[model samples]
Target: MATINTAVLDTFITLTGIKPLAVDVSPVLRERKAALLSILPHWEGAEQSGIFAENFFPDRSVGHRKKELDDLIAQTGNVTGSTEIKAENQLRGSFMLNCPNGNIRVFFTLSPENPPLIQQLDFSLAK
Candidate 1:
């Protein structure tokens, strides 16, 4: 029997059904975009918020990094590129942004589940 089966390929096709794989940045991008679109102006309630909450423990100083994320979203329009696989369970995705301020890279890390969570999000301009 083949080591890899059709289910694997089928999943890829289904998850990325909307767009061709060659052009589809990533399936997680779809989930992120969908959630953001629905909860934008109020992303705190988005499904992905749980992922953020787990990663960025809220501090009392101010709100969590939600505001910072908001700012980044405003700057970086959308994902106009492909997602890079850092590991079997991690992926790196960049958006369509050109900031003299700083270059941002969103690292997505997997939980026990198949759908990963947003891990480290930084926009440090300092080299």
Candidate 2:
């Protein structure tokens, strides 16, 4: 099991302004998502090794997570469109985004104290 680089993770947070809770880097390797690969120089070896590209989500290295994400991108074209909408009455705090090929539903477990805003940024080109 490879370990995630604290320094690299810190840099990522600083540049993206988002805490690294979880991440998917599979798309970085694909031609469609290769542009994102430049942002992460630390993952070069891992990406070539085919660590996460072949494996699924589990307790593993950041490189593996990226590989898995690339695989996911291969399966799901791209996050085409998204919308910030309210959740159902039953859910305490929930939000969802509709991608081109799929939808991401986020359920907030924490209270409404300084909720994180979901911003849409184009990270890759669609296929």
C-alpha TM-scores of all predictions: 0.38, 0.26
Span of 10 residues, lowest total lDDT, candidate 2: 116-125
- Return the clash pairs for model 2, or none: 25-66, 26-66, 26-69, 26-70, 27-70, 80-100
Candidate lDDT scores, in order, read 0.46, 0.37
Alpha-carbon shift of residue 122 in model 2 (angstroms): 21
For 1-127, candidate 1 gives per-residue lDDT tens digits of: 3547777877888988766434445667456534433543344565445544353444211244557655764665542333343232224443322334443454433334556555444442222
lDDT score of model 2?
0.37
Candidate that scores best on lDDT:
1
True lDDT of residue 74, candidate 2: 54
Flag clash pairs in model 1. Answer: none
Give the Å error, residue 32, model 1: 2.4
What's the true lDDT of residue 92 in model 1? 45
- The local distance difference test score of model 1 is 0.46
